[model samples]
Target: MFQPWLATLLIWIPTLVTAGDPAETPWISLKPENHNGKHIVFVTGDEEYRSEEGMPQLAKILSKHHGFHCTVLFSIDAENGCIDPGVLDNIPGLKALDDADLLVLFTRFRNLPDEQMKHIADFVESGKPVIGLRTSTHAFDIPNDRKYHRWSFRNDQWKDGFGRQIMGETWIAHHGGHGWQSTSGIIPADMKQHPIVRGINDGEIWDPSDVYTVRLPLPDGCIPVVMGRVLSGMNPEDGPCEPEERDGKTFDKNNPIMPLAWVRELKGSSGKTQRVFSTTMGASQAFTREGSRRLLVQACYWCLGMEEKIDGKGNVSIVGKFKPTSFGFNSHTKNVRPKDLLD
Candidate 1:
């Protein structure tokens, strides 16, 4: 039912840009450019859970080709898909989370409420810098509240609440069902120089959801960059299935394998360091290839360090087009260029 003039023409079609027209626009407003700092990006999801997938076109392509200063918090009411109403009084104050440097969780099974889950656990313990995509590691589930019952990894107080010490692990299950493969081709040779895997090569097979398997054990000095190979499936809300086995063929038993992406460090017992970057797989729109949208826009520009602001001079277009309202929920608007939606 969301069609407020296509969400106000997809929030003003990024803000048209046609000087020489290289074509890679989408930054409607939030000024502050020349950015080497000030990264603020908070985009929640669950547009009716899976209403055709697009998550505000990946938050308008990370605030228009990565200059990032975005703020798109939306749970859209969340119901049978598990509640999430406006993440704590519709967060976005505190001078915009103290001019947030980064935080891009993409919700899916949220159920917030306990004073908005302690204001999202005190805004991820205030350490800052996070980028969990795909079901945001079981987002947030309040079985009956009880302070949010460990957030969910099947439950058992998994990570001891607050989204497993801030997204180290929570929702495990994906034995590779969507398609494609090849992960972590063993890149940890001192992180291949890091900087988010420089350019990222070795095998390369982006665009294909569902890939997890890092049980739990990251947030300490966390830094595992990328590790692949385990893919099976099963997490479509985990229900109705059959066929199982692990080291002996016969998969599909509701697919339950793991580890699709990683990069962490959240020490914080008060020490404070935070900086996470998980990825069970981009919340499907059918993989949006281009190496899965440049591996989720280079893992959100290396968890907000900006990774030199990536613009290698090619491929970065994602203009606008969301359409999917049958009540399922999907209306990111549709401004191809109506004067860039009246910018």
Candidate 2:
């Protein structure tokens, strides 16, 4: 489902600079002069769920409101230089990772080259912080024959790939109806005092995206923050459905929903137990909600060891207008370059 680009990238690569880095790939950046020295690099390359649109908005909020330098890289059609999620192999600017204090990734089954992937592997192995959005659980879908196949989402040697080992879980199934059923966040009554969920409340989490199913007990070190309750309707105020019973156990559906947002502590090759924030939410449609954006912003502070800086009333407002398209395969805006995102 590759859409052909109207113009080749060679015609625009040299002249495009959203953040002025001048890389020959589709990457947008925002550097706030008011500044925290940390750099946040966002990787977006999912064919569905519009990570490309969501990531940029997030970078804008972080840069404008919080003073962090942000860079967003996309999947590229090498020949034409267009941003194409269908083209999984090429995502320029992994070099941005080397200098990044944090990496926020939202990709699905990406089969990147060894050269590009090595950078990610180094980052994870080094124990730096990271935040994974929907689909990133199974980010790399490399073939077994490839040198970096060990990083694949469902690889045998790695025991469920990057998402499970590094983050929390790999791609599982959908607990609710894929498109028809909506989900809402139900904060644990006891964890309300936690900084990440400080300003958030019960039933405030609403998204058109369905809830993702994960096995009980995420990797031993993970802590569940907000659980996703399957709603009978799409609206934020929709009532949650009763849990379905199976195999002699009555599942209390919304009474005790699936953990959708969580944090894990894993030891990296650097002998440091770095923080990892993994969430099953955060598509473009989901980002339209202020609650979801705030959760992720809080996570950035938690991951960077700045939980002390979190305030219940911190600014997480969107920097510009964000009218994102519905999530679907082959639904991205075409004939646009990385520089186009600046406008």
Candidate 3:
């Protein structure tokens, strides 16, 4: 008779070793056929708006449909190795950024250690392209005394940190009513022919997340691509917002829509100008719409200087079943590891 307990122990030891090993940073990587020879790394750690849930879905689309190698790194619980967006400090597998051609960042208020942050800093300094989604504008909240404090969203020296210096804006107040209003995309008249908005039509893109306020005219070298019309309700068929008194002034939200999406050409420390795509709407619920998914897919091609290759009606179908958790604070699904998404 074989000893069942002894056999189980031997089988379990290897699994324990791999999970406990510090060298093995937990992450999910998706490889694509018909390789485009580019690697896109996604950093997801936002508490609300569900970057943790959305980034992976986006990565899968990029890989399975577009032929880019996509890797998604999430904030992990130290004690149990589960994906935990509430953990504001640690996001393992950032070293993947070293070889990344483009970075899709959606972190909010992260205060990672210097060693982990150095990887992101080095990548940004390399003059590579970047895509900033929703809360990424206010991504870091490092203390003033920290080594990478300049990246903090509220730093005096850096002047709004990476969001302002690189992505063209930082955390301003919500332009639309947070939960009550929705955002409808409008292609700027001048930008209708732009490659990024190639296949998308006005009003096709809608997100439940409200528009964020950005200072007027945007910054130098930034071009607005999509304007967001504030809607009266969360449904796509909802009417445009009515005139209301706000900030002691009468305002009509739809008259002058906010910049929903834009592109920037910023000079990095390496003396090279890199392309950046920033969109104020990328909540997990946003991608449920076909227009929202198409816009992002095309933007990735545009960022990589492959704009000419974008198919106006390319396949942006969901890779597999994707039922994302609703956007909220402290509502992330617990005990779920990055590896769990491999299925």
Question: Sorted by TM-score, highest first, which candidate order results?
Answer: 3, 2, 1
What local lDDT score does residue 220 receive in model 3, on the 0 to 100 scale?
94
Tens digits of per-residue lDDT, candidate 2, 1-343, equal 5444635544333222355443454788777766788889999999998898888888888887787888899998888878899998999988899989999999998999999998888887888999999899889999999988988889788898888987789988988878777888888887788888889888766778889988887779888999998988767788886667789999765554689899888877699988999999866878878888888888998999999989867888876567888877888988667766765
Residue 142, candidate 3: alpha-carbon lDDT: 94
Name the lDDT value of residue 283 in candidate 1.
43
Task: Kindly give the number of clashing pairs for every candidate.
Answer: 16, 2, 0
Whichever of 1 and 3 has more lDDT, that candidate is 3
**How do the residues 1-343 of candidate 1 rate in per-residue lDDT, one tens digit apiece?**
8878998767554443322332222212243233335555555645433422444455455556555555444443222222233332232222344456676676756665565556555566777777776567677666755766676535665553444556666655654443433232234567766766555553342423445555555556556665544323222223233455868988652233234567877667567766788765554452444444566667677666666755433344564654323212343332232123212
**Which candidate gets the maximum lDDT versus the true structure?**
3
What is the lDDT, from 0 to 100, of the residue 282 in candidate 2?
A: 69
Total backbone collisions, model 1 = 16
Find the 10 residues in a row with the least total lDDT in model 1.
Answer: 334-343
Q: Measured by C-alpha RMSD in angstroms, how accurate is candidate 2?
A: 7.2
The positional error of residue 168 in candidate 2, measured at the CA in angstroms, is 1.1
In model 1, where do residues sit more than 4 Å from their true spots? 1-56, 61-68, 71-100, 103-128, 132-174, 178-208, 216-240, 245-265, 268-271, 275-277, 283-319, 323-343
Each prediction's TM-score against the native?
Answer: 0.31, 0.91, 0.91
Cα lDDT of model 3 by residue, 40-114, tens digit:
999999888988878888888888777888888999988988888999999988999999999999999999999
